[model samples]
Target: MDQFDWKQLLNPEFYILLELGGIKIGLYVVLFIVFAETGLLAGFFLPGDSLLFLCGIYSEALMKEFSTGSDFLNVTFLAASISVMGILGNMLGYWFGSKSGTYLYKREDSFFFKKKYLFQSKDFFEKYGGKAVVFARFLPIFRTFAPVIAGIVAMDKKKFMFYNILGSILWSYVMIFAGHYLHKLFLSQFNIDLTHYIEFIVIGIVLVTTIPVLMKLLKKKA
Candidate 1:
């Protein structure tokens, strides 16, 4: 049998921290990534779904590597940390939106300021109201921009917080846990080595998640 190429097996795009041998650094990196992706405007281009899933897979590997007996506790901590990071990011985004609402309103469409996107976000917010915060969590680009739009429209802070926390908890738990458990499942059932294929799986997951959004755009264009 041939030896597995650990270096070549890992996904270059997804294994940023692991490739660097920075498990400890990965935690902080994941936290910061979550914060930026959720809070900052530039985060619109960051990997959200696939990254969270990969983080879950990485968490599982880290637990095994450290020989941590506290599997449940570790999972809880990972989920909680990501959930908090996402929530805090949304809060920062809301603050920026509130402060910049007028500024953004007067600005014309350009590379960064696409009036259509703002309109789409506004329409989504208006259509869903507070629930948009929760629903947006499942979306890709919309998830990043939803909170900003909420603040731009001056959504009730208390209401936004309620939905924000709930959405963050649900989103973080679903993606991370799914990744973690799915890794366990495949390894156990198929006797497959996850390290060799996890990258491809993550890519497939991203494509799947993006399908609905792409379809929506296609329909609009049609």
Candidate 2:
């Protein structure tokens, strides 16, 4: 069940470059990664809170070197941008789930095709109703599936969009700002290595992203 442990790949330097290298470079990568994490069912475990928080703090750091923007504007842009990414990503994921997922994915099917987790997501949404889309956005595993299941169950598109945008923006701001403030606390309390923290964040994202797969493999072995 052991993976390549790609989580090891992320390091503090990665974040420094990710946020600092250039807007052109860091911007697209962050957008794409965020999309994949939200859209792909396999990506549920990716660190939503931690990732955004880390990016937010690092983005704050970058403001010193580059005219990123006013502090308020920076957070606003990041939150709005993430909102769009999460929503758009869900649209695509839902499309795949609705158009082909029903036939292509069956719960009683083979292990490779089984969407057991999707069923759990369905229950969560049913219990919470439309708000589950927004509510689950904060939870780790459910955050990923709520949208895709919303699509599968034919939750109203307009409703989904409304909640999705609201949730994404709120989630982004909370995490990013939390990261920024936490960084300040660390600095004020004692000298801390920012680079090391960034690297650890990236690695954490990678591990969280891969955890589900590892869990499934472990089940197979059992």
Each model's backbone clash number: 0, 2
**Which candidate should be chosen as best, given TM-score against the real structure?**
1
User: Model 2 TM-score?
Assistant: 0.71
Per-model TM values vs. the true structure: 0.83, 0.71
The C-alpha stretches of model 1 lying farther than 4 A from their native spots are 1-23, 61-68, 105-115
Q: Residue-wise lDDT of candidate 1 within 1-222, one digit each (tens)?
A: 446465542342343354354344566666777787768664555677777887777775544544357766777778888899999999998998898977766778764446566666677788889998998887777787889898988989999999999999998899888877887898899987565776587678778877877887787689
lDDT for position 34 in model 1: 79
The reply for model 2, stretches above 4 Å from the true place, is 1-5, 9-24, 61-69, 107-114, 189-222
lDDT of 2 by residue, 1-222 (tens): 335456533332343345333353555556665687657654444455566767767775444444456877776676677668877877776676666657645546443233666665677789889898887777666676777777778878888888888887777777777776677777778767554567576566556645654674577569
Lowest summed lDDT across 10 adjacent residues in model 2 is found at 8-17
Evaluate model 1: give its lDDT: 0.76
